[model samples]
Target chain A: MARLSPEVTALDTMPNSAATPGPTTLGEPTIDWDLSIRPVRELNQFLHDLAHNARPEMPHVRILHPNGRHNLAVGLQVPANIEILGHAGYFIAGMNQAAHITVDGNVGWSVAENMMSGIVRVKGCASECAGASAHGGLLVIEGDASSRCGISLKGGQIVVGGSVGHLSAFMAQAGTMVVCGDAGAALGDSLYEAVIYVRGSIHSLGADAREEPMQTDDLKTVADLLQRAAISADPQTFRRVASARQLYHWHAEAQY
Target chain B: MCGIVGLLVKKPELRRELGAWVSPMLDCMGSRGPDSAGLAVFAEAPSTDLLRYSLYDILAQDVWPTVLERWNANVDAAATLAAHGQQATLFSTTPSALGKDWLSNYFPHLHCFSVGHVIDLYKDIGHPRELIKKYRFAELAGTHAVGHTRMATESAVSPAHAHPFTSGEDFCLVHNGSLSNPHSIRRKLERRGIRFETDNDTEAACRFLEWRMSEGDSLEAAIHRGFAELDGFYTLLIGTATELVLVRDAFACKPAVAAETDDYVAISSEFQSLAHLPGIQQARVFEPAPEQIYRWHV
Candidate 1:
């Protein structure tokens, strides 16, 4: 239970507790956009326009009253530090190139789908497919993730502080995933080159996925992800799960 | 895809604002289901013997007054009607069985959406943004409500196909996904002399669960039996006289989020619909787990 409630290290860089508009004690100017007053289209349009002309410094943009709107801060190619003050909707930061996004509350499906690079952190639980088909970047969930947390991973690192639901990381082709807590059924299925480390119980393994002996490199990898994710789990307690390479080749004798 | 929303107030004073709070939620879900919409509201019973029947007619929106006057003069004199467009609520001391027969015999074209002492159902074939205004959903007041917007994946788009399907007294259900085994379940229930209204899959699930409850099983027990009986993806929300219930299928592929606070409990297919909730920033928001039963009593 203690491991599941790991501290979110993203708070260190976030604005003060107020996180309101205007300059904070950090001296960084904040731009406020309230969804209750303005429409989501205006916010996305402004963010999209800014993506073309890259700003020099870290423009601290604050969005309030998200009310679960979809596609907020998507296709971001800038280095702007954006903070969402409440719960958000699906695809909050899809196709994110190079931006630092911090969600203060829970999020809907696909927080950072197909991200090429950058960091997105969630302070609360996430729904299904948290980081599906991401080619690059890092996603950190400080709480439990629902089913298919990282399904069909294409080269992204996902660190889940708590449990992940069934069929997580299905048909993964690359990258790594670290679960500090329990994993639901079918941890990984038909994996290719993607690696998984679970510190707690695994309900079951999917087809072609098997537990392998943890090596020195595995320990180093888990240690690095845990350190970066701000989770307090020991590297030595995790078990490695990877593909068995049994389903890579088709055999005529195999029964359907 | 479809959309589902349920709200239950914990305080008595909050009951008056139930419609005001839930109207925006239904409008937010208009994007998910643009073809049709439906809502079921649960309020306090006027009396133990009083039954409220929601009647609908498509031929004319103003037919409710004539139907009400005719029923008052011919069927039950003590019965009163609160008509709203084509949708009308008949309040009477007559039992539901006799009430159904009376409506069927006299007004053959009028459809009975629901019959209960606390539930009032309104459904139509249009986007939620349009239907909410047409049905005057913002003026209603209740302790709890469950609403649905349908996309009509495999069925015809009609008011009857809309959700919040009720089978028994003071009970209604709405679903967010499809069922693969609805025909089989319908066949099984047909053998037990259960009649159906439409070919939609959600109605099959609604009737099955309500039938299980009629056989002396609690809603929780009926849902457990539903685990083995119901197949395919679903996020079901049910509203009763005194409680609101929610559940998802084994896969839980269909999305549903719940926001809970000291004042109320709200459930929706996505967090966006619940963004307007009170104390939303401090609400204990979380995704409901698959095959789990979450219930809140009024």
Candidate 2:
């Protein structure tokens, strides 16, 4: 694999420097890569190398002109902060651990699928399955999230400022999903041990998923998540939803 | 995966560059779809009363002479024909309804990709870039346009199975995902006397919209009804002579992005297609919500 020389000047000598915002002269300048000058494959390869290379401190990486390409910044395992300047395609930051990633534009499907830890934020809407099967971390979307936003989520906190599409949180094993706006049909279908809070109307709920009274603790959790997401919705108006536990254990006698 | 793109020029000054701008957008989506490609462009009609029909896969060396000879014998009207490759466009003063019926009966093998006063369709089985070069898409001028590059998940890779399916007069549709229940949907429409050109799933959706519009439902209403009826993942871009409509399925599994500026409204299956458009950096970009309909006048 080709490695970027350490002696290379950050952004001053980078190709397409005219389009880029220039190097991190004002802040911590660890690394800044522009996708406009290099293809997505090279970027992914560089990220892979960065995760494997041993260093004294985690590197701060900035990606520019993501342009809705798929599988970007996948499988990162470092304690770094990464910022994407434009929209990204499917699985923008999947299988991430100990990295903080932020997207200035929207993201395509499965923004943080199977993420083990860290934070991922989207300034714009996210496509379907925004955080599917993610086990840990905080995933935040300032805009709407499409269907199956947190399908089969094991553990995490997903906060969406806008509406969510159908069948979100379906079969989620353990997680907290907070929606500030309306939810589409069959929300939380066949849900398992996940809590959902919605401030707006739910089109429908899935089998074994029902609304529960929002306790004081639930309100506090929702409030904290909202603050972290930078959204200003009333926590008092939110409703809690969880699995009814009716399908937790199957019965052979019921099959007849 | 399939890629769909639409461009509606809001500024009259940019009208002539519609194809030039859209060609690059379509080319950027080459990786998403490599099986077949199609495009439909809307331009000024020669006459208000004349109806234009664009046909593909005519195959004959002298396509215009062969088609004109047969068509002129069937219909008595002032007509013009233009042919390139295996594709051809016909403009006739004959009533649109009568012309369509007669053409279907006489030219059963030819595919009428579009029928309208302002729309002309070009499509074939090849890569998007190759198709653009063959069709000289970048040089063609239009007011609005829609294009599709198909990956052929649901149908055979053939010229007849290519996208930009014409639904009603002055309207065409391009879809980026598969339908879960197209066979049943086709049966339902067939019972209603809606004819289908191919086994492609998106064609069923096109015909369904046509049937709904024929029953007096507006485009918005028909699309809403589609959300209730169709089962599957899809991001659809429907182009009419006067408007462009975008919609996503309730599941929103397929991806779509829209960018708008003072000059145009552009939609594509991914954002890279819109990144090269003029003033795109300042354009307001957003994902259309699931089951939500977005319409822009041309």
Candidate 3:
């Protein structure tokens, strides 16, 4: 594995390093292994056992499984780049922190659950309940994502290029959920400080989350999300959804 | 992953001439199918031929010989071909074929076929370009073709597991996505006397199409049936004698893009594969509508 040089780190920290072209300093520092195949159960067990006894030095993990494999690369806190070659089963690269993970193929449900930090990118589509209860870090789904993304999101950002399933951002706390495509029903149900910005129409908003007027702060957040997700779209075209105080702490009086 | 390219020339003499243009298109998608590469080229069927069958029947390996024997004895294929004015040829070209002996021994039906090269399907991944160059895949000619690069998950990765898999017949299919309902569909198709060699969702798709055709459904109608019945995320590209069809699953949980040109149309899992095709004055590129089917005739 190639080590990230101190000079590259210095350049990344500098404010005016944009003049240099090509190869941004911030991708996976190293990637180990080439194309190879392993059974689903065997690969899952290997990743599980490795996560338990993983050392700091093992910073790169490459997996080659085309068929969906459930529970691959769960509960790892090391700083590594785990790349899954093809479409994977549920909980792929789940509960990840410090290390970055990339799936060259599509992913199944609950990707990056309870993740504290680091990045989880899916080059293809994602199943429902993606990024459920995630605390911090960035979850980028290049393709469309199913429902319940960032549900109960305590922190971090989730940027999806394509349409999302129903109940997205349900019961979210502090954080942001950006959808470049249309969002499904019950978007941002009973939200707190978390902000939901969608470029397209919402099927239906949840209990307290109403259509809030787009503000300058909301625009800035949406712009940042679009820039990060690599989707070249105008930020002014989006709408914001925030919790309405009317439905907060629902009691007998508010019962309709 | 391996790459496959074929062109349907309006005229017979133009068939062999299409090799130059078709090679690059196939070479471009080589990244999708890297294990083994092949082109199943077909000349125009004789105008008078009424019945032609491309069979991809998977049974227990032990029952294969008996099934073939029964099929050959029960079916009067030569008389049918003569009545239709169509000449049929079959080739089993793969890395495993040591010599022409394998062809003569197993398939006595085929008279002669030109087999200059066959690329090693195993021990190869992430080397699509090198493999294409080695096999001189650019020189092969055909009217319509399908190609696949195996990323083996449910099935073994071997020459036998390669894509553009026919039912040993004319129908070919290339698929991108998983089938959540494989077990149910496989069992149903099996009971209907359909054979399955690979456990991949793609094989099921082929069998389903064949079964529909057998039940007297048109190619387009069979595809529509597949869209409604099949489950899971899929982007299916199917090629038959007269048309090329692209179908996306209801959810479209995977990626598939199509680019239509004045002279030809290309579809792939990604855009880079079809970017360089000729006469693409206005690239009509878009994602296939969810649960919608698109068909192009040759």
* TM-score to native of every candidate shown: 0.92, 0.89, 0.51
Give the fraction of native contacts in model 3: 0.00
Q: Which candidate is the best by DockQ?
A: 1
- Specify the highest-TM-score model's number: 1
Docking class of 3: incorrect
CAPRI tier for the interface of model 2: medium
**Tens digits of per-residue lDDT for model 1, B51-156:** 8999998776587777778878887888889887788899988888788888888887888999998999999898998988998788889899999988989899
Worst 10 residues of 1 chain A by lDDT: A1-10
Better of 1 and 3 by lDDT: 1
Candidate 1 deviant stretches above 4 angstroms: A1-29, A252-256
- Chain A TM-score values, per prediction: 0.87, 0.88, 0.78
Off by over 4 Å in 3: A1-194, A203-239, A242-256, B1-32, B37-136, B141-143, B167-169, B197-200, B216-228, B279-282
Global Cα lDDT for candidate 3:
0.61
Can you give the DockQ of every candidate in the order shown?
0.75, 0.56, 0.05
- Cα lDDT tens digits, model 3, A5-95, are 3221212222233222223244433322222333555544544555565464644555643344566677766666677766665787778
Clash count, candidate 1: 0
Give the least accurate 10-residue stretch of model 2 chain B, judged by summed lDDT: B57-66
Q: Give lDDT per model, in order.
A: 0.86, 0.85, 0.61
Better of 2 and 3 by lDDT: 2
